[model samples]
Target chain A: MNFINSDKIRKDFPILQRQVNGKPLIYFDNGATSQKPQQVIDVINRYYQHENSNIHRGIHTLSQEATNAYEKARTTVLQFINAKHNHEVIFTSGTTGSINLVASSFGKKHIHAGDEIIISTMEHHSNIVPWQMLCEEKKAILKVIPINDKGELLIDEFKKLLSPKTKLVAVTHVSNTLGTINPVKEIIKLAKTAGAFVLIDGAQAVPHTKVNVQELDCDFYAFSAHKMFGPTGVGILYGKEAILNELPPYQGGGDMIKTVTFEKTTYNELPHKFEAGTPNIVGGLGLAAAIDYMNNIGIANIEAYEHELLSYATEKIKKIEGVRIIGEAANKASVLSFLVDGTHPSDIGMIIDKLGIAIRTGHHCTEPLMNRFDIPGTARASFAFYNTKEEIDTFILALERALKMLL
Target chain B: MNSIKETQQEIVEEFALFDEWMDKYEHIIELGKDLPLIDKNYKTDENLIKGCQSKVWLHAELKASKIIFTADSDAIITKGIVGLVIRVFSNHTPQEIIDADLFFIDQIGLQEHLSPTRSNGLLSMLKQIRMYAIAFSTKADA
Candidate 1:
């Protein structure tokens, strides 16, 4: 195992230096948004300091340089996902926006009345609501693939829901609330066989797993940069060439047009047709830097590390009395959602926070999933590769103390 | 632990009762149970709170000086917590409601025990109660 230099790594993040309440900061909210490394931060700073100019339009030196860097960042993202073409990826604000893009453009174009759209029970509201909105407008029927008590998707049920009427099967590649890693490749295959387009919400999946969209063979994949240790305002939507070609342009703006005459306006090419405005230039560069950092560390290694952390934390926390771990899927990302017996989750979070530990408390943006599980939402401590087992130990110890405080 | 007269006074006197005074508590917990069971029929997209961890239906009404509160949760423990909240706030005078301190929450050591969302719910209950108090206070002002 290549041991991370904790002291060295700690120095990279400015926020990690601060204490919460009185305790040293232990951030376990990586599932929500990973802390950015110094390298990523510095790259962002450097761009603003030296290379802050608009891209593709300015013939001046700064514009050309900015344009090159921006396109280069796109290249970095393309390689990060191992996509077949650079044009396949379109930058949106985040995963929510990316899913909305497909729903608004493709969903509006393709689906007619009586057509079906399928999603899993464990999807975040972002995935659920947009489709619901589209279904209401388009007069399409939205079907859900129920999850078992164990928090695993019933693939058999998903298969049952599919038929000729199924236009799109939108599923979360990794469930945000439950941490269940759905068998998306297989789900995609089943959906494809039924002649439906599949869109995978890769938001929760991208930061933790090695996601190769081509191998998965989904029609579209979406993820956010913020969750992956990049800037917050940027997201990626990767669509297959054939699917990308079929959809009409999403937003009409300056760059998105080929030539705009008052009488008739033509559209631009593949990716640019979707990117309509002054893009998140700094955020794109920062995201590219983060991808570079992750790639350097190696995705497989990061995945293995997260697997180890989740197992280790689960084992430790489970030993405490009255601590019930939620979302115990056989295949999971790096989130540990649980409840401490006889204690309110807020109490657990507050007490632990005093010890300089930060974990997410509440529905995690999936109230329906919370309802499905018959829970108020679990206190979640999600991990990333930069996080250490010692941090988990500190968190577990703090939780034990927090639980006692409630008594 | 207090008698009905005392419970009535506590309800009338404290906004805190609406927060969790009822839940330490039998009257509000029972009232939470009274929360119409939120018919399985109505638990659709309309009733949902965007960030709430569970499906919660919060119902309140003002009678004389007191505001009656009732709620239900799909989750058992949350239902129990709601019962606590409704019991405390269901009956109170506007002046008494505003003047009463919620040390009882500190007494029960519950605010610390609640999950952040539940704490928000606890606060939401308080806000709902206080809003009623303010309304009653205004009615008198009128």
Candidate 2:
């Protein structure tokens, strides 16, 4: 296994150097959004500074340069995810936008009355609500695959949910709240057997692990750049060529048009059919730079280092009395969710923030999952490769002090 | 009964002594523990203050021409904030409750210490209290 020099890695992210309240900021909010490295920030700055113009349909030098760079960013994402074609990668605003694109375009065409859509109970609101809206619109049924006490998706329950009427299956590759890595490869195979299109919400997966669209063979895969240490306004939606061709255009606008007329209009090809407006060109370039930065560190190395951190945090936090860690799935990633016995998650979050530690508390945009657990929410401390054991020590100490004040 | 300014001054004096936020939070938690109980019947959804991370219920009744406000929260710190609010507003005339400027939150530095969401909840609690005062004051006109 390749080892990551975490101390060296931490130096690259400029935001990690700053303090929050009075102390050095220990950012444990990677599941919500990762801190951008200096490389990604510079790429965005360079784009606005030198190469700032709209992509496509430009005859000027800057436009051509911007178009090339933006397309190159698409190619970067294509290669990053190992997608079969460059045009299979469409740049949406973020994961929510990407999911909505698929949900609206593909869902409008394929989903029908009496058809069923299957999603897990642990899905983020982004993944769940779009399908619910689609189901409501089309009079289709939405099915939920339940999780075990350990927060693992029950494969048997998932199998039972799969049927011929199942038109689509959308599941997160990693639960943002629980950190449970779903068996997407297996889920895709089963969904394929049922003749259903599957979309994997990879918002939490891309930063922590390697994601190959060709290997997964998922019909649609969606993720945001911010979650992976890139700019916030951009993300990639990887749809299979044939499936994307079959789906209608999500919006009607300039770039997505092949020809425009009063009565007759033709839409553009593969990825352009989905991306309608002037894209976040600078953000795309920044995302590509982020991809390059992650590649340089090596995702496998990052994953290994993050896993060690997770285990370390889990072990240490569990040793503290009155602290119950939520979501102990057999296979997990870099998120830790916990609740103190006598204190609320909000109070814990507030108390810790005063000590210059940043952690997320609440339903984590997974209200259904919170309902499933029979709790309001949990205090989530998610990690990235740049984080360290010392930061975790500070966080643990802060949490202990917070618990003392509250309890 | 203490005037709003006197109550605000007392709170400012009390919070000024605690240098560490930890000690201040401990003090708030203690205040939460000491908050007087509301009637169980009053703790209903109708009295809920919207936009709180923790569920906070505020109930107000105009008894003997004075507005008595009773509030509760599931979270200790939020309940303590409610206690601070009750200390300033409860047992005052409806018009006095409506007319008074709530300077105590600023004096106690509660708004600065709270997270954005919690501060919004605090504002919501204040809004709810003022709203009850308005309702009762109008009924007095009726």
Candidate 3:
């Protein structure tokens, strides 16, 4: 018996009611992006319809209202993540933007030639590339912490890689491809012992679990709103106030600057320093609505229900012949990634798409992880709180149908 | 041998027999199995079309002014579509290959495979085919 009433919860999402290819849409691609609930959608629609205005500059009533709403959204995020201060939350494009902001700004201030930045093998391309670019520019060394066949990070190897020269440790809290929940609190503690700043990529983590930056004591945490049933093009970057103030601004534009001269310009304070331009005001509002929706259900309940779904799906998939489940970590989220023997993932994906089952089948932006597994990619079906056991059954039937056609 | 347009028409007609998407896919999977295998040597990175989802390798050669195209994909469905593409363009002159419009894919309900977002490199493979045609045509002119 699940605590979450997913059938009642399903009504909030209109996309769930729609059909695809003459079949009911079974959205298993939540790992790619989650479908927005009507509440979040309504907030966005209402904002654009009535309160559309550029934030923080104009003295107009609409501007003030939008500005207050956007700032309130920041506070909502701060409370949601249990951050220390509202100024610590900076709005960026998405998780990629947030990570890049740290890589660029933090790298500019602290990173020097021969300084080491550590990341793991399971990092998404967004997490890997920005650091790579930073390393290349600063002549810094980027060391990768390897994972085992089960996709769990080898902590012993991580300790070996850390030294006095280590400047920062960046890793995903939950891997997008493998769905492995990394021991980030332990990772952060270890990094602190090495005198390194820790930045956790919470893009995959925040949607499924409760994240407390204060409890974890990480220097930076990044996540996207779209993955959590909010609008796209908006994300939050929570940094320690002291470090964010010390680091240079990522981008230079209107809101980020205090005053400008031809030769000299003074940057704004924390939050505004990182957020350079007129931000995604409506996206921020939608994020607040999404956070409200989550709070209404309770994150603990969402976690428990999703875990049950993951377990149920995992057990059924295990019984399938010639199917290999990747990332068999002891701790995982609601992500099921697998490959059927003697069949390509894309062929399976194409066949199942016709059945109106949307699952992601590719490298999933973690090409290096695919290389580590010595496979091209895996077909992934990630579940959310709204996904029911019956939907999982339908997905299993679809998978079996796909396998029969391919094999 | 049928002209490229005639071959496309024949493919469209054959696909028209299947009303169900599953039947169409089954036919494609069967065609994929029957596709003439590209030489293993040509499966190198240089010949590989960079698709985000799947890998496709293509090799073309000219014999007596007629281009012969041999292609392969790790995915069976992509291979099947590639076989259809090869059927239309293979044994045709470079100019004819260059001039041919690929309407058969859309007609057969396989247009999604050719979408840029699909990332199977079918669209890229089609572009590569034309590039091969242009390269060979230039060689003939020179």
lDDT of 3 by residue, A1-407 (tens): 56798888999999999999999999999999999999999999899899999998889999999899989999999999999999999999999999999999999999999999999999999999999999999999999999999999999999999999999999999999989999999999999999999999999999999999999999999999999999999999999999998999889998999999999999999889988888888899999999999999999999999999999999999999999999999999999999999999999999988999999999999999999999999999999999999999998999899888888
* Model 1 Cα lDDT, one tens digit per residue, B1-142: 4432465455445434544322333332344445564456555554433325444556555677565555666544456555655566566667666776555454444565344544445555556667777777788778
Comparing 1 and 2 on DockQ, the stronger one: 2
Q: Please name the candidate that would achieve the greatest DockQ relative to the true structure.
A: 3
lDDT of 2 by residue, A286-374 (tens): 89999999999999999999999999999999988988878999889999999989888988888889899999988898999989999
Quote the lDDT for A55 in model 3.
Answer: 90
Candidate DockQ values, in order, are: 0.17, 0.67, 0.96
Model 2 alpha-carbon drift over 4 Å, by segment: B50-52, B113-116
Candidate 1's residue-wise lDDT over A1-407, tens digit each?
A: 75555567677788888787666789998878899998999999999999999987898999999999999999999888888998898989999989999999998689899999998888989999999999999999999999988789998888899999999999998887778999999999999999999999999998888888889999899999999989998999999988888899888887788898999999988889899988999989999999998887778888887898999999998898888888889999999999876555754665566578888878888877878977777899998887889999888877776555455
For TM-score, the strongest prediction is: 3
lDDT of 3 at B22: 98
TM-score of chain A of each: 0.98, 0.99, 0.99
DockQ class, candidate 1: incorrect
Per-residue error (Å), model 2, residue A171 = 0.7
> Candidate 3, residues B1-142: lDDT per residue as tens digits?
9999999999999999999999999999999998776998888898999798998999999999999998999999999999999889999999999888879999988888888889998999999999999999999999
Quote the lDDT for B8 in model 1. Answer: 42
